[model samples]
Target: MSESNTPEQNSQPASATPPKQESLLANLLINIAIPALILAKLSGDDWLGTKWAIVVALAFPLLYGLRDFLQNGKANFFSGLGVVSILLTGGISLMELDAKYIAMKEAAIPALLGIATVVSLRTRWPLVKTFLYNDKVLDTDKIAAKLEDNNNLGAFELTLKQASWMVAASFFLSSVLNYVLAKVILTSPPGSEAFNAELGKMTALSYPVIVVPSMIVLILAMVFLFRRIGKLTGLKLEDIMAAHHR
Candidate 1:
């Protein structure tokens, strides 16, 4: 008879390894730089022209997002919303809608996010937990244990709510800036080469004008939450932060 296999040999792995994270530099180049360049430089009669340029420029982000979802094998809320936002942008530009509609759309996305962040507080999972206190960034289990031992859970909850508010505020600020920037940079009528180039300029400027300030606010909120966690749990920042983060 054939020899029986050992249990170890028979056992399958519990799960597949997680997908590798994408490079930040590559993400920026594909999502921002490439699209900006295409729209600004190629939206002319000799090249792709205005309408075709919008299609080609938007295609990069659409495909990149799809690739990211396929690699991760899961869809998060923000990623879904991003896909929708890109679709709306392409639709508006292709239809040759007024620039004001584009400005409104720009403001609406962040405004909706801000409202959602605030509303999530009423549910079991607060947005702050996702953004600031998740296992990716913090030793959440250890922090929970410490809070339990010190009977500081109540205080921790309150502090977390405050952080959530700060995050919402940042989203609101982004909404305002997005509208202003779109309105300021996008003046030419849609379907024109001038309009396409202006859209490209707006896309390129968005990082420094809106994204940088929003990131600063988010960083401040994270710092505040971490400090409060330190105080409540009597743990040092390095101790509470995840090993990878540390």
Candidate 2:
């Protein structure tokens, strides 16, 4: 009877099964569905007045807030600001039927992100670090020891700071380019004309053209900086990416 009881205790029932992996539904919604809806709505003939455009543009940040709430339990300040800026500029364009707001939209998103990046660098919180890498399992003592021994914390902070500045600078330059394109190439007026021409150009170019290149440049620069720093610190790019994915 003891032998029989031991077998019963050791053997588990076959009815239980492992939990299913989480779906990629949210990723789909954000990356594909939302952008599609925004593009479709913007392309439509219906009048997207200033108020409506503002409301719609504001939705981006709100959605991001919702995403943060669901995923991380906190709203991201920088991402929220970027969303708001995009909406503000986009709304302005829609209301006046000008293209300046639309053109500015291209510049606004990156600029806002850049600002957020700078603000985040000032704190010991490592806000961007949290976003790009998962440091949850990191040993505080180890990290503290590393920070103490290495004089490179200042350098690391500067790298992040400069990277953020670069993003803002790039966006500012892009905005200026768009402005010039509107005034000289498209013959757009300062306010409404520029807005309209900018919208037309954005429509033709698409958001990817503007966003992808900027991000690519930013990431590449960051990677190069990371590599240089890592060589000195004995860290690896894979380590950063793994932390980010987690």
| Predicted structure with the largest lDDT when compared to the true one | 1
Clashes of each: 0, 7
In model 2, what are the clashing residue pairs, if there are any? 50-95, 98-195, 98-196, 99-195, 99-196, 100-195, 134-243
- List TM-scores for all candidates, in order: 0.90, 0.53
**Per-residue lDDT for 1-246 in model 2, tens only?**
122244443442231122111224543355334543554355333655323433453455467556766776666665566556555655565555455445555455555555665676677654445433223322223343454577667766666566556655555555555444433433443234333333444433434454456566667655655565565456554543322122
Question: Which ranges of candidate 2 are over 4 A from the true structure?
Answer: 1-72, 115-144, 150-164, 167-206, 236-246
For TM-score, the strongest prediction is 1
What candidate 1 gets wrong by more than 4 Å, as runs, is: 1-22
Model 2: what TM-score?
Answer: 0.53
Worst 10 residues of 2 by lDDT: 12-21
Scored by Cα lDDT, where does model 2 land? 0.48
